[model samples]
Target: MPLRAEGLGKTFRSARGAAVRALDGIDLSIAPGEFVSILGPSGCGKSTLLAILAGLDKATQGAAVVGGKPVTAPLVDAGVMFQRDLLLDWHTCEDNILMQFKMRGQPTAPHRDRARELLALVGMESAAQRYPRELSGGMRQRVAICRALVHEPPLLFLDEPFGALDALTRENLNTELAALTAHSGATVVFVTHGIDEAVFLGDRAVVMSARPGRIIADVRIDLPHPRGAHIRELPEFTAYTARLRKLLAHDGRPDHREGVRP
Candidate 1:
């Protein structure tokens, strides 16, 4: 589940037939089982880079390799979660999770236990039979997480999965996600705009620049795993957040002078 991008670049043609660069000279390597958070501004190519890495889109100038193979199409071994829950209103929660296997033309019975386990992990066990319309926003998102993980994919790509939730709900889910995936041995690439969220959950925070995006910094989060909400109050946690904030404030012009405060 290791991922590598070599000299990756992407460009698009505007509606008016103008060329617009979205990414450039991006060289990044993520080790297996590492959780890397991608942090950037709104218009930066974070989502675009993620799409290319996940093989949903092709890089215009370089290559993306996953698990020792060139990514030519969508990866079957990877699981993706987006900002919205995307659950079907008619399907029950457990059935929503089971749909992953159904879509892959795989047997659902064999994966039922795992689906239930994931639901219990996110405190949704009792709601397994509930439809999406009956669940709260956070509960719906928990089901989405279970759906993404029930297949036990070796790689997970999350694009602002908690961005739509309120602050308290987001923080609670952050803690749950850390605990859920702590030992899953999955290489996770999480894209988010929250510095604290990145620091709390990532083994490394990969900061990106503005449009025509490029990596500005790859910061190592030295905090212990199984991080809880209280960990955010620790000085080390604040230091990491501060460093990331400074890097982002530069808007792609990282201050090399600012060393790791932790």
Candidate 2:
């Protein structure tokens, strides 16, 4: 169930009839049940690579394979979540989560039990009847996460899922997400701009270059899993963050959004 990319590249026809290369010769592999974070500057095509891997779009060149099968179109073997929760405005939390089941054509009875279990896992059983408008940003994101996992796909692609939350809530949710992934034993490909977040959650972190994107550095985070919040206070954490800062700053502009509070 590994995700593999070989000589992956992407291009687009611009409005003016010029070809623009977004990703360039990217090569990487993510093992089953591993957590890998892709970090880079805003326009570096990190999201583009993610889209190709999730089979949302076709790669202009090279290959991407998941679970030993070539990815042609959107594959059901993986799940994707983005920064926006994308919850239905009027649907109750549980109903919104159920939509995932409907999309995948999964049987209702088993997933119904699974959905309620996920809600309980996220400690949101109390809010199961609430609408998105009634929940706080953090709670809504939690519900979104529950929706993402309802189908129990082996691989999950998260594109800055915590990017919009407040500092405290984001930190708390990071802890929750790490624990949830551990319990589920699902492989993850997480995209983030926060070095601390990457260091905390990733088993391996892939840093990409500026436009005409390519992988520049691949650092393995040797930290033990169930990486508790307390680990952030240790020297290893500080050193790891400092190293990432140095790498991100190598090109004059760092790999991050300015004024990012999370």
Candidate 3:
């Protein structure tokens, strides 16, 4: 597994020092190069889980490991893309991508070429010199995606990366992202609230319940790879969407399906 969480749990402290459990007893694993999308209702600890796995935050209980190493701090081999682009307004797209190296105390020279290659890979080479302010929301997302992969990490975690884009742009980026994840050869743990997007992009969609979050099910996407927009029209895709919605709606309850559905 590229990523693994055993007996995972997390709790937050309020002003009055009350324990607010965000995640509980979560056990999940992702294989190398596998694209796993996490879907759930609001406050399910979906992003919280991603943050813990990326070592941006610590789990109050259990462990999260990436590439056989326990996640204590941010690991060099894992990359994370949050909801916002978080790109500096001053730098051009290329420099913003290269910033990944600079922030890590790494020499940018070695990673500059890779950054260009990734921008080109995402069809953003032309925007290399353009600042974040010069880019559209969708364009910024493309740049963000390239920046995340510039380091060539083996594992990537994303949290609602496309929630802000328009429908058409979001769909286009979904196509682009699906292709990117496949070609990057990196295991991806994507967190999204969109049921259709989850089924469309994930090899397996992990559905979680509400607060005190726990994995309710792992639904395999039976569709083929290199999937295009038309894939969502397929029976399997729609079926998975419906199933996930059903799961999220009835979450924190019994296993209505009786077992995990492939």
Candidate 4:
């Protein structure tokens, strides 16, 4: 499903009645099956913009629509994954994947096969019987990703899902996730600080300005798909990364915490 936003604005009142503008006049469009990664500084409204579109919050001005429907409340057609795995400590991985269906009051039998298949794709089939406590951080996140996609939602939102992992592990998950998102054919809005990860997974990268966030630049990734470690060594990869770095380093305040989540 396509996503469209127009003149979107969000404002929050401070403790002392000070109004803080988080997002202002943001216009964005994401086509079906396109993965767009959002990169920005901490105070920037990366998560806030997502919240409005995902129906986690309301927009102060303008409107956000998914598949032509206004996002005034939580939509069942969308799935969200956060930085934390949020897996249930007691439920088995299989149950965790089925949890979404159960919560939706939808039949679980129809999606059981898909749940198992997604687990195998991430090489976690053998661990399906294990609980979250029995798995490592990487394993837990793999399940989280599966849980998010189990229902086959057309629109997916992920906020720094791999931020807590080590570099090597994060890279591995990034590769797996890109492949999975492709296979599932979901239009994704992924917010991340890692420029390489952003470019690696997205069809396009959207860079946001500082506070009162608005898109500052949009860079298309013409690199090859099913991208591996070797792709990073290519000149195009370096050029894209360098361009994003230059954009983030503007105004004498280099966004050193680009990899840090808000």
Query: Best candidate, lDDT-wise?
Result: 1
- lDDT: the better of candidates 2 and 4: 4
List TM-scores for all candidates, in order: 0.94, 0.93, 0.92, 0.93
Query: How many pairs of residues collide in each model?
Result: 0, 0, 0, 0
- Model 2: residue 167 alpha-carbon error in angstroms: 1.2
lDDT of 1 at 23: 94
Q: What tens digits encode model 2's per-residue C-alpha lDDT throughout 1-262?
A: 6999999999988999999889989999999999998899888998899999999988998988898887998977677899999999988998899888777686566667778888888788888888999988899999999988887778999999999998888887888889888887898999999899999999998998888788989999988778779878889888988898888877434547777888
lDDT of 4 by residue, 155-201 (tens): 99999999998998899889899888888899999999999999889
> Candidate 2 has what TM-score?
0.93
lDDT of each: 0.91, 0.88, 0.88, 0.90
Question: Residue-wise lDDT of candidate 1 within 105-156, one digit each (tens)?
Answer: 9899998888988899888899988999998899999999999888888999
Could you tell me the lDDT of residue 156 within candidate 3? 87
By TM-score rank, best first, the candidates go 1, 4, 2, 3
**Alpha-carbon error at 49 in model 3, in Å?**
0.6
* Cα lDDT, model 3, residue 18: 98
Instruction: Name the best candidate (by TM-score).
Output: 1
- Which 10 consecutive residues of model 4 have the lowest summed lDDT? 248-257
lDDT value, residue 261 of candidate 1: 82
Give per-residue CA lDDT, model 3, range 54-140, as digits (tens).
888999999998888899997767778888989899898889999888888989988777888888877788888889998888889
Q: Residue 196 of model 3: what lDDT? A: 80
Q: Please give the lDDT score for candidate 2.
A: 0.88
Report the Cα lDDT for residue 26, model 1. Answer: 92
